[model samples]
Target: MIGRGSRRFGLGVLVGVLLGFAFALVGASPAAAHATLASTDPPQNQVLASAPDQITLTFTEAVRPVPARIKVIGPDRSVVNGGSPTSNGTKLVIPLGRDAGKGTYLVTFRVISADSHPIGGSFVFHVGAPSIDPPQEGEAAVTKADPAVVWALGAVRYLGYVGLVLLIGPMLFLARLWPARLSRRVPAKLVATGLGLLAFSTVAEMYLQGPYTAGTGLFGADADAIMNALGGSYGTTHTVRLGVLAAIAVLLRPFVRPQGPSTIDLAVVSFFAVVGLGTWPLSGHAGVSPAPAVSLVADAAHLASMGVWLGGLVVLVAVLLPKANARELGAILPVWSNWAMMSVIVLSLTGVAQAIIEVASFGPLFDTRYGRLVLAKVALLALVLVVAYFSRRLVLAPARKALVGAGGPADDDEELDEPPVKPLRRSILAELAITGVVLAVAAALVQTPPARSAADAPPEPYSVTLSTDLYRVRMELDPARTGGNSMHLYAYNPNGEPQTVVEWTVTATPADGSIDALDIPLLPVTADHAVAEPTFPTAGDWDIKITLRLSDIDQATVTQRVRIGD
Candidate 1:
């Protein structure tokens, strides 16, 4: 018999192992996928020609222009630019002030893009004279990944998926094995446990997903603030997940009741329940599963399988393992094991498939924050599986040895061979505990970018090429950032120099072809770039009309319509 001291030492060892496991997760927790300014417009490590007209810094994603400021450092490291940087969208620009003296200028800025992401970056450029013509600029919006949040929150997302699956996966497996009208209705305790886990993870996820998307806080009250942020891809997906979750909440009533379930009924219930739960990856980093559609489907399958496997173990220990009768367990363990093993295999394969899709290249795997966190997660998974393998091999097979003397039907060979396993039950419980930790880690991984980065979506590059006449004009929109009002115009006279014009008139009219020719002030943004800064006061479709007078008699006008969403 195990003595008290022996038990204490063993318990200490178990606690130490769990603590160590948690520490490993913590060590990896700080690592993140958040992309910061890798480099900037004027660039870091390089001497500049006389000062450039405007400044721009590049980051991992689309950035907004709110805290965007250019800190023009003096020889004493004092700021020069008037205040903050002016953001147009993809680039941040500062108007050159009076007689800008000679010296290196440090332009620092912070911005919140339309995506609700916050980014801070800086660059250095020199100005020779006061300045040349103003440069048309866009907002510096880079949608960087928050690695820490991704890792931490991802665990919640995936854990929620696991809870739903485990919460329901077994009933389906049992239905497949046992005939309809016979599978025991899931117990209230089991349903409560699953729902409890789901709720906990969801609360954690809400906190994580909100700020993580916008690069906000990890533990602050910002989660509530991020409600509107759900309008995006990640938000949209989680929204649907909520709907599926609601269904589960309602269905729990029927599921928890004590009644036998039919195979068809169980399958239908399990599939939809999981569908309501597992579809999260679809709108998240894993949605663009590397295997494409098949990979995506497989990911869902894998999630469902994991839910069944892990959640089932929880059920077994809580509901079946504690029972004094070995007979009931003997009859069910093997069948459950078979299904559990199958689910494990499926989950592993699908996870790999999704990983392949997310980590497009080897560089992102190590060089990117997302990649490193993913690798850490993979390590944790390997550890959990190691524990699982031990339970399956050493603890389980021998526990069945006790069944040798038990009297049972010969036809029950499978169940008959397995006496009520008791000692091995501890191993099952251990495995389930470790599995919970794994799910926590997985939750964080889900919130992270599948691939080290989303460069895979590679925005569709497009530009408007215009061939206007005598003084040929070509307007090309920069591909670095898309949407919003963006275009570059190059005009050359027959001699190919600056087109000295007697009159330059540009205007905007309603797209309705309204003869009113919308009366609006034409703001001169750049020598070559001009804009109609009309108060878009309201959100709607608006038209921009450009009228250029080369000499007064030689004027050309082009009208373009733009659509804005609220």
Candidate 2:
């Protein structure tokens, strides 16, 4: 027959799952955490009277200046940028010569974000007229990062997280709750392994940063490039973390013993541990967060709590539980349970704080990728907690009862009935598995753009090529907004050749007759195309009239209706 504890555990799981679903249903969308280009002086696809002497790009956050990462190719497939690029404040400036002829100039840029992620994009602008063919020779510069680099970087991050799990939790277990009889050798090796992984990941990240930002192959990042990367915020934090790890390696020996370190030694190591934890947030999204100080502290707390809880589980399953006698486990489990409870509380609180700061509002929690990952983490954590509750209630509680009733008939009978050790081992192993997935999601979360920052990010591109019998006229409304919108028109003959537009005119009127027709100024881009910037005052269905004269003798007008939203 099932015990009272078993029934309670099952009920708790059911309730937690229901609550998780309810929360997901009511939650707003999830958001991806990524830095974006806020604006550009010569906006994408803009037409200019003459080539500007420089191109300036403004991002939502500060970024590292990697000269080789920014390339400007003119209509002739020749580099037009005159000097080294400059990164100042939130702007990246690329100088160009005034002689950058009348045609399209494609600017491709790659920069390391404030959070140490590599972001790259390309934009094109026309001077005097559109080029017959824009430079496409070095198209490699505009593509995504090398797949090997992507995999290697992700693997390194995963390794570092695993190392953190091994390093932090086992140390605490040894210092406080470990059984005296258990050998310290295994636990000590685990700590050393964790430290090694973290140190190796940090060094690898520095080397990878150069190739990542430059959009090059893995081996492409050299010593000079890596050194230049170190000069940036991401590199500095990594270097500091390496130093902390070195100190930790030296001081952690005493603490790995069953008797543990002296109070002074413990104090010193703790201080460095906290400092090292700070480096993670300082080099990541938290450092540039809206409330940087608060977010950084919360992130550090979150990391520390995760290490204690998840890492503790690892030690309990792999070493402590297996080696300890029932009496030792009865003693160790309760203390470990209390520690886990405390870690959970800290994790929950700090997680909520970081989420609030990063998510900004309820809407993004359901709407964005970051939010979805967060929800997954929350759901999995809830499941882990449910299992933990059962483990404590059925396994630890019964074991404690047996310990109290030792040498009595009731103790022997109860121990035989439950066999709590096997169940407890299984529960802890399950919890570790779930938390491992949670850590993976956490890694992804750090890479994403915060919901708050992405909430007001630029809209998706809106452009569609249209065709007609008299002449194929392509009308594009940039950003598809209600207010000011940039529009471009390209005309072609029935034979699919560029057709000269002698005269072009456009009129926009509300389809519902709420507003009168307004003229839009059309500027000639080439023999076959013209551009215009029009303002739609309100949100509604609007009709656009495009009249183009392919020749003095032949002209055609086409009307297209489109809906605009606020």
Candidate 3:
């Protein structure tokens, strides 16, 4: 009867989750990806008539500027920014020095997105004419956090997850299922240890955020960065989490005692648990998602369900099975099985909801890092469920058969023969081991950009300067992918002055000779400037040959190779 009911419940849960996912898909719209450059004043690679007083950058989302990281470098390789960059929602305005020169200028910026991820990139614009050699910052164009800090943050997140499982499981079992004759010492110690680990991990994460966002080493966070971290939404949620933990600690004092918790104490602790779980989502991708309310509730429920189910398994394998006698096991196993089943149902439902909101489409699910991790997590969870099923069968089948043989149902005082313990323990242990790996994957998922954002992210612009005996040609390609690309060409004399051109001819051919050379038509805007829209049919290396005619007698051709990506 128990097995049949569990199957029915599982089926209903699966149907409900599928229905919810379908509805989410129907209502879903394209959400803004990570913070990306949407547009810029004095547009990249363009030759402006004059230098503007300021440059404005529009991003896909609101961002907080990183100090000392946003600057404009003039043609003379000197800082030309007049003042600090100011942000108005998604737009950032950088004041340019009044004396900015008449050559290439590089604008580099680094900022933190609303979701706590750092984004950095650079672009170039020309004043009057292109520079003979543009100012370069090398790898500093795209700022990156230190490897040690990244690894440490991931480890701390995983530690927090482990603590949740350990703490939630034992405390729950002690309150409801623990036998009166058994000592509470071991379970109480487990609860204390879990609490300590959680507290430590939370404090560590708060400190790590400063360095992580600053693109610095683990110990490189300065006073300003630390203070900024504390002032942001990430810091606010974590601070609330610490407060919630403190309240839980005080309320739990009576809960883990031998006498168990009073009804009022249980209600208060439950309230704190919901608030605590909420902090995890409010500080992550969910807080900035398209459906923030739905994402928050789903994420919180997912955490709670994971904590209860995995934590319960730990308590069952380590403490209950080893110590409880036949009659005690008969009474405890059935109730625990029911709770585990319910927790799994909630976990599955919330996991599906989050995937729908974050991944959005099938293409991203199969193409992006975030989506692939989700697949790996699902595979691991399925394996754990298989082991859980076997474990449940072992417990229920024996307990039911023994009850039938003993007449109808055994009373609380009646003794029943113990079921096989060794096999059950092995199955539970296997479940816990797989769950640990799943937790690690979850920690990684939190750090990765969502599939929707990764898939929608724009490709980097490609630019190159080629030289011939007669002249230098700089070609700029916007989003060099397998599609129509806007191309701009600027001609300069060997002495770094604008060179007049009478005619321009351009053609592109695949490096492997897969296709014949295709002529690209160019329209001249000035004697030294021309623009065209060229289409690359496929993704691979292509050779572009440009023939310029200074006069009938002074023509030169330059060939440059460019790579196009899918």
RMSD of candidate 3 to true structure, Å: 3.6
TM-score of every candidate: 0.54, 0.81, 0.92
lDDT of each: 0.51, 0.77, 0.83
Taking the tens digit of each residue's C-alpha lDDT, what string does model 2 give over 54-108? Answer: 9999987778767777888987777878999998978999999646677778888
**Model 1, position 490: C-alpha lDDT score:** 40
lDDT of 3 by residue, 117-218 (tens): 777778898888888778886523446778898889899999999988878888888778888877788888888778787888889998998888887788
Strongest candidate by TM-score: 3
Regions of candidate 1 where Cα sits further than 4 Å from its true position: 1-121, 129-162, 169-186, 213-228, 262-271, 288-295, 324-327, 360-380, 393-420, 447-451, 454-566
Cα-based lDDT at residue 362, candidate 2: 66
Candidate 3 lDDT score relative to the true structure: 0.83
* Per-residue error (Å), model 1, residue 241: 1.2
lDDT by residue for model 1 over 1-566, one digit each (tens)? 12345335544644554454345433432212323454466654223445555556655444445332334553234444554566443556654443255534555565543323444444444343111221211222323445676566656766576667556654443434332323345445566566667777766765565556554446532534366345445555555666666666665554433454555556666666656645555555444333457655766786778777876776665555553234444566667766766676666656655555566555556755556766776676667666666555543444345433333222344453544344456667777766666666565465444443433323321223233464534333222231343333444454433454433354444455545555555444445444333433333455655556776367776655554322
Ranking by TM-score: 3, 2, 1
